[model samples]
Target: MILKTYRWSFVVTAVGLVLAAWYGLSAHLGIGQAIALVLILSILEISLSFDNAVVNATILERMSDFWRKIFLSVGIIVAVFGMRLIFPIVLVCVTAGLSPAEVIRLALAGGDPETPGTYGYELHEAHPTIAAFGGMFLLMLFLNFIFGEKEHHWIGPLERLLEKVGKLEYVQVIVAGAVLLIVAESFATEHGRTVLASGLAGIVTYLLVNGLGELFNVEEHLEHGEHHEEGAPARSNGPTPVARATGKAAFFLFLYLEVLDASFSFDGVIGAFAITSDPVIIAIGLGVGAMYIRSMTVHLVEEGTLAQYPYLENGALWAIGALAAILLISIEIEIPEVVTGLIGLAFIVASLISSIRYNRAHPEEAHAETAAAHS
Candidate 1:
């Protein structure tokens, strides 16, 4: 059963290992060193992104099978190449006025000991802008979840209070905007305008992508309308409009997922510099990690983990909120990546324990929900 469920994961892992070995050998590093570094990088990426997997599974489970397939296949390509490799090069090219080829050369060259014009140096210089944009985007994601009403509450009093405040018009947006302004003003003195602009861009991006998804959500609209009529079931109406809208909705959802992955990648890319300034190594390591995360997401959906563990989503969202706050604060402070990873893992484990206890206490309720899902 395990092999059947994670067959793709196993395949990807095998491919990643072979690639990691080749890259390491080509870089002229010893085989042992290369393999060890790759292993470390992969482990770090997985630990840091475990919460990301949970959050992704929550979203992926809602998508149609076609979209899920795209996420597992095309999505991995985008995540590995776009975020892990090309993103830094683009940032350096745009910010440093270097050509793409030059950026790639500099990245492969690692960092210069004598001067500060290497790819790693320039990318580090752009950290403020990266942090502002990614921080604000993640903050909005966190705010929306916390502010929205949920039936199951992990942190009852706090979540309940936020839910009440959520009834206020655009509370999440207001809170996100206020926080952005405060962070920009207080900590972004050197690049105040740039930080503010980047943060605003993040907010705008989130609104546009999320709004498009909602607009294409024909199923949600049908379900809302069904509440007003007698004996109207909340399912797809038919084959035509449902199919068309599902395609559009899936496109928007794909966009949203990509943007979310980008936000998550910002920190990992920056932190990879701490491990090694070699862009190739960083890419190989993070790429391997990204594949695992994607596989984990699919596994979660296939196994109905979210449906079984109701509070897991809540835990993941809470972790996102914590991560967002940390990202904003990291502009002024030097928070260790391990701390970030630990906090997220802690929330996930706590939620899992809560879910297990709930299952034991209410076996009948658990069985009923499982049956409903299967039916």
Candidate 2:
């Protein structure tokens, strides 16, 4: 049932591309080149975005069905338009004197005829900064996965202490918002400001769009309380679990996904600057990538694939988490985006194929079957 629905999404995605080619290609590019561009970009985007789905699935799988649907719909909007579109504009205003339109125009020019301040990194022309950005981003992402805490503690000492404070909710928001502002303020130089601005923009956009989704009952997704395991059987129709739950868990989940996506994108986006500075191409490539990732995420959730391949999912999550940190480092170092994407993809695909083969060999191995489950 889950896989069937996802099949249609894939079809729709394909058909949509066909329609885009039929109409939009002639205006923007020649037919053959346009088709090739679309295919190449799509493949690159999908490959880069594969880990994003695993990370997102880890959270989306835990949500109530209602919220899961919103994640499929509204979340796509945020990722495609908010992150891929508005984000570059934010980067432009702070880093270059160019307005978003001018930046986009420069990108469309494609560095063919020499023009000053057009469509590329004047800074990245120097090899060291590129290396510094790429290396640092990768290092941070890798360290966070190895060192960062994974579990949530509801009645933990920290929560208990926070409980003592009146208006805890507002305090949390204010603190997060303040941290974002401080980070944004500190990046005064062109390169630093571009990174800080783009990062903060992703954080804020996630909060606003995701927050509104919860507020409006766009879907019934809710965070599981400390007591419940995600797949535990429940009474089906009694007030629906999501309606009874608070929105904080859902909000935080979205926040984490957004930050993860932004971090993972740092390398690719920066790398694209190497290809062409055309904010338009950046938007198109990243926007298309974001859409496919959303589709992949929803497909994973509906198919219950993650539930069946826990270790594989875990590995992919860590891979993406590591990739995000690497992206931050890449802002300072010059780790190749191609290497990062290829290595990460290899891990995920190998794990996925292994999981599939294992399941096939032991047909009943799924869903914690009998003692025969032993290796």
Candidate 3:
């Protein structure tokens, strides 16, 4: 079962490692050094993105098989090529007024002693804008998840309090906007205007993408005239069939997932510079990690892990919020990527332990919840 489930991931990882080794060898580095670097980079990406996998699983579980296939296949292409490789080049092209080819050259020339304008240098210079946009986008995501009503709560009092506050329509947006403005003005002093503009753009992007996805869902429900029975298990042996017009809904969902992944990738791309400025190495390493994350998402969905561990999603969302706060703070001070990653890991572990404990204490309740979800 494990081999069948993760067969593609294994194949991709093998190919990625081979490519990484070849790239390192071509650079005249020792074979062992090249292998070590690739291994470390892959591990770094995976550790940093573990919470991302949990959150992705929550959404993936709700999607149809068609969309799931697209997520694993097309989604990996976008994550690897689009975000890991092309996104930085495009950023340089737009921000530095260089051609795509020029940016590629700079990326290739990243560590050269004589190259005055390396891609890594330019990318670092662009950090303020990147941080503002990604930070606000993620902050909004965190706020929406935390402030939204949830039937199950991991940290009962805190989640309950947030849910009560959630009744104030758009309160989460208001709070996120206020925080963005404060950060732009207080922390981003010299680049305050730019930060504010980028932050607003992030907020707008989140709203449009998330809003469109939600609209598609509403439309789907209206067309089918079927409301999911409250307390019904979200998973089942025979999933409900989607509507004939599911293409549009699925497309929107796909867009949402892509954007979500992009938001997460911002930090990974930036943090990668600290390890090595070589864009090729970063891309290969993170690409392998992305594949693993995709595999884990599929595993979680296929195994009904979320239904079994109800609080896992809560922990992932909390971790997202923490990471958003760290991103915002990092704009002013250099926060180690390990610190950011650890905060997320801690939340996930705590939540997982909580889930296990809950299951043990109330096996009947857990069983009933699972049955309801599948029912």
Candidate 4:
């Protein structure tokens, strides 16, 4: 049912574009050219986001159905609008003192080589800043993977404390309120919005990203070493399914995935300034890319791909952390999107292939090896 729904939606989007192309065709614009532009952009976004989906699947597999549903819906909204649309405008407004409208104009000017800069700054000049953002975002993702608490070990007092706080219904709400207040305050202070935006961005990113993780229960996979067993496997006559996360666990897991997704998208949006700035074009391009990434994630999860390639999942987590670090650093220096994306994709692909080879070489020991790693 879900697959059918997704396919139907995809078809509808495609058909709508076709019809719209006819109108553009009538306006002296070549229909083929417009369609090609959309297709090319879509593919670029999807290819760049493959690593994101690989990482996302590792997180989503730990989520319950309820939260997964929310992720597919609300999460996309945040990705397309909050991160891609609103974020760039906010950045431009803070750094350049340009209104969103002016920023949009600058973005449109991106295609005209005659214009010296987009919104008064060359993309090459901005590359360092973008790189810094991607680097910081990626670094954090890598740390979470390498330094994450092992599962066999007790979470001790710290986990218990956070768990207690997490149990409170009002805690996230309070945090959310604080974030909004800071955003407002930053907007009001002259010349301080940049710093304010950075701080607020971190806080919001942390809340939503971590919130999703907690909701989806992916943290469970990270907290427990791969070797630890909570209990004996259930004995079933039929094929057994991977354990599904539920309730609070699922919600948090979903939240974490979304947060990570947002972090991953930071550089892409900033890089997109090099493309057309028609807010509509930018939104459509990035939004389509986000859709494809989500679809890819769901496909991986449903197919039990992560269970098949455990190490790939590990690599993906590290990549996510790395990307997070990249985002934080981008606030200071721009990084080339191509380099940032290629590095992440390389790690995931390498890990996945290694896992495949390892599993093939030691079929009988696969489960044992996986369980041991958990511990």
lDDT of each: 0.81, 0.53, 0.81, 0.57
Whole-structure CA lDDT of model 3? 0.81
Candidate 2 — which residues are off by over 4 angstroms? Answer: 1-4, 7-28, 112-116, 122-246, 272-282, 353-375
lDDT of 2 by residue, 301-325 (tens): 6665665663465457456545644
Backbone clashes in model 1, listed as residue pairs? none
**lDDT (Cα, tens digit) per residue for candidate 4, span 93-194:** 655666777777776554442355564254333333333334333443443334333221122465335444544555544543453344335432432344
Candidate 1 residues 1-375, lDDT tens each? 577656776776667677767877887876677667767888888898888889888677657888888998899899989999999899999888999999889988899423589888899878888888888998888888888767578888998898889879998889999998898899878778878998999999988998888677755657556223565332111111133234777789789889998998888888888888878778878888888898888788777777788788888888888888888888777688999899999999999999888889989988876775455
Clashes per prediction?
0, 26, 6, 79
Best of the candidates, TM-score:
3
- Each prediction's RMSD to truth: 4.0, 8.9, 3.5, 9.3
| By TM-score: ranked, best first | 3, 1, 4, 2
- Per-residue error for 372 in candidate 2, Å, reads 16
Q: After superposition, how far is residue 153 of candidate 2 from its true place, in Å?
A: 20
| TM-scores for every predicted model | 0.91, 0.62, 0.92, 0.66
Preferred candidate (lDDT higher): 2 or 4:
4
Residue 312 in model 2: lDDT: 60
Q: How high is the lDDT of residue 200 in model 4?
A: 49
Comparing 1 and 4 on TM-score, the stronger one:
1
